[model samples]
Target: MYLIPGFLKPSTSFVPFSEKTRSMAARTNKDNKDASGKSDGRPGLGQLAEQHLEDMDACIQNSGLAPDTLAQLKLWQEQQEQTLKAWAKRPGREHTSDADRFGESLQDWERAKATFMAQAAEHPKEDSTARDFFSHSSAKRVNTDTVMAKSLKQQYPNLELVITPARTCNLIAYAQAGLASFETIGESSGKNPESLSWDLYVAPARRLDGAQGGIAERPFFEKYLYKWRGLEFIIYLVDGRDGSQNYPSVINYYILTPTKDKAQLLILEVGRWGADMHGEILVFDGGYWQKSGELFNSIMKASWDDVILEPTMKQAVIDDHLTFFTSRETYTRLKVPWKRGIIYHGPPGNGKTISIKATMHMLYNLKPAVPTLYVRSLSSFSGPEYSTQQIFAKAREFAPCYLVFEDLDSLVTDSVRSYFLNEVDGLKNNDGVFMVGSTNHLDRLDPGISKRPSRFDRKYYFPDPNLKERILYCRYWQSKLSDNKDIEFPNELCNAIAATTDDFSFAYIQEAFVAALLSIAQKSKKPGKSDEAGWTEDLGDGWVGILGGGDADGDLEKLVLWAEIKKQIAILREGMEEKQKVQM
Candidate 1:
């Protein structure tokens, strides 16, 4: 019933009891009670055993374990101590063999662990479970994940097993998106039979369905036998958290299906649909290809009619894109590589961006829908060279794709100039890639990229708007405010505003119109309906705002639009001239 102090040593390896145990065995404490159930002042056997284990702290700590496993072992040791106390109730009566058996059990604990370790070594998984999946983690949780997967495969020989890190291919999320279906088989929900617990919680449901309630619950770690496409498969997912952030904590998926093809088909479809996010455009940023539906929606507003370029130049830009994409045969027949690049050079805000957007919209309307790849920046975790390589690789993949390089002057800096040109001009064929780069200052571009027709085959200049275009812009603003009834914008005011806004870009004119409208809106006293002559309505998307009716010689200073726009145009002109001086 009693064991001496210092019985165990500082290592978990088995060893005989120390001299302290035998010396104590040869004597008995004078305070020790006899088997007649007599009381003594000595501490109970359970208390002594607890103290012994505490004294063997180094031994237990050397076998470092998970908190959960250590807690379980502690509880088991406490229960063993209680059993020894029960035997001590009948001191020296019998059951000395139970004490020996308890020591042997400690050895058995390590023996079983050793066996599991030996088997675990004969497997895959980088020596542990795939715990950490992101940049934030690198730790591995000691568990039976690898062993369990191997055992399951052996147990189900007929079923083909395909294991994947959940991050690489998430089957559960695939089923959740309605891209595929995984119905539970009879009497089984997806919980692994061996698992005793699960991690599940409720999060925002509006993210999944707009009309649904605010919250919905989903399981975190679970397994089930599911029937997908008439094929039975076992899907298991588990969370392997390593207790801290800086460790390898990842979720793993184990799929056991009737055949490898069935598992592969499901995986392929999930990967395809996941990468090709619906209603989203692929834009390069932060060194990766991100899907942006917002960017796609913004480009949808770009119509060629919104661009105030002359018909010939507008049609030239249109044909440059249309003929290239549709005339793959023409390039082949002409013995030239189908790949081509175009540069849209201009003063700021004269329509370089809108033209590019219009081209993107035009491509989207074609049969089978050509995708567009937009590049915003070259800054990334990897260097800019890596960014350039990935950009071209993706462009090649999505060929017949419009690859836009907005603000090319700033993007292709001296540090990456050579590398950037290599990707664009190297031996690799970039056929079907209608690459376009826009820059406000064409002089800033390198001659290798700017002057060479082999690179950018054509350059389209988007200069400041001419007088006729400015007149049409003002009349369009007049039509927009015709119903306001506060600002009287007569036909003469359009001509007067256009006459004064020389050397101004369309952006400056738009700013003038907006400033004038805002000034009118802020006035407390609204202008009454005009006694001035109004022109016939010419409401169309085209540049037909020069409708004739009101006299060109009529007074324009009295008109509200004319008055407000004059001040705005003066302010804008001053700012533009200052900018020009600084540039010089």
Candidate 2:
């Protein structure tokens, strides 16, 4: 039998029981206070207290507490009960009945004994010691069913929570609770209720080639995946880093339009945007996608560009992406009943890809806490030469995900374009897959792909960032510089650079700064130069090769620095432009 120190005494000299037990006991006595309410029922309460004291004495004689502890206990109980009754009555509600409170305490004590006996029976004595040590302190036993349900409730508040085999809990149960509750609203409250859902982990993508395939199912998986309604949206992030090359992290999103015949997965070629590396992936459900495209196109074609269109066009791009996403009314008005395709056409380095990312943030409301999936390339999936429909059907199994295709036009050729046309115009148009494609040579795009009305009715042209865009670009770069502040790009100098940069993309602007800085460093390193801050203003100007900077003479003076700057800018721009010209 398990023993509580001393339950039979009302002493003024002992260490007391726990705050929880004393409070509960006080409330029980308060409930029994007679009409006079002057500790009228002390005798009855004392009888109950005495019974507890005897039980503790019996157990202590066996081992836990000493005989002197009995006197200490009696003194402590009398002192604590007086304060507890007053505290209980202060609340003004009828006090908790003595029977209910004591019954619960007894149940707790009995349950602890039962668990101790069970563990001792199953394990050897030495192994049981740890369980006994913890149990002795009065911690509640872990009731598997209750614990599991409570955990599920806390993780997924929106879903109708139900668990079979109540005692079972695992990562799978945790994941399904999220998936089933994806479309739900409201928070959950109750014991072991769910908490916020941050991410959903699916079974790892597997390949069936050469004796390496098997079926896997967890409890919640069996319950949720097959029953998902609406479109299966998926986005993927592909890490593109190689030791030799540096590339920004890229993520792509796609939605699968399911059909009985086959599934077609459409890729959004424009990239999404975030303030930082830890930003959330935005999902433009079909509705958000269509509306955003319409509003964006209308603004581009209208005077909004003239009023807000600064040279580099950076603000316009950010604005267009944000405008559509921030307003739900706009989303509802522009969203189509069926999914529509979007095409992003622009020059290299003008953020054709980044625009897609920003659009996603807007679509998903840029809420950082939500979990999203990003698939960088379609090639990652290996299956039978499946139709587009099949790929999407498989993707939805990983739903609440984004399916992104970096560059789609290149993937679809004249011949393949026809196949793609058939899939989109085919029976699978309503699956939840969102499609987007980006291209540099819009004119060269196969007319068969472009001419279709709703196939890709929205075409966003990302021209080189104009003057205002140039300023914003400078600001963006400045914030990325030593301090997180926008440095003023000298207007005359900026205008000259903007005008001279006929078709320069944002990438080229970055290169220009790098070249200028390198020129300064190289000049300062020249054999005779004592100035460590690099070249003087005159030399810096001469190195950049602006007009009236004594061209031939200065060029001769700083030949090596000039050459290095020119080479650095040209090589970087040329390489990036050429690579971006190709479709992903």
If scored against the real structure, what TM-score would every candidate get?
Answer: 0.65, 0.37
Q: How well is each residue in 70-98 modelled by candidate 2, as lDDT tens digits?
A: 33334445544554455445432233354
Per-candidate clashes come to 13, 76
Worst window of 10 by summed lDDT in candidate 2? 265-274
lDDT of each: 0.65, 0.40
Q: For model 1, how does the per-residue alpha-carbon lDDT over 497-564 read when each residue is reduced to its tens digit? A: 88999999877887776666557556636343231223222222111222222323446766666788
In angstroms, how far off is 240's CA in candidate 2?
Answer: 34
Error of 2 at 361 (Å): 2.8
Listed per candidate, the RMSD to the true structure in angstroms reads: 15.7, 17.9
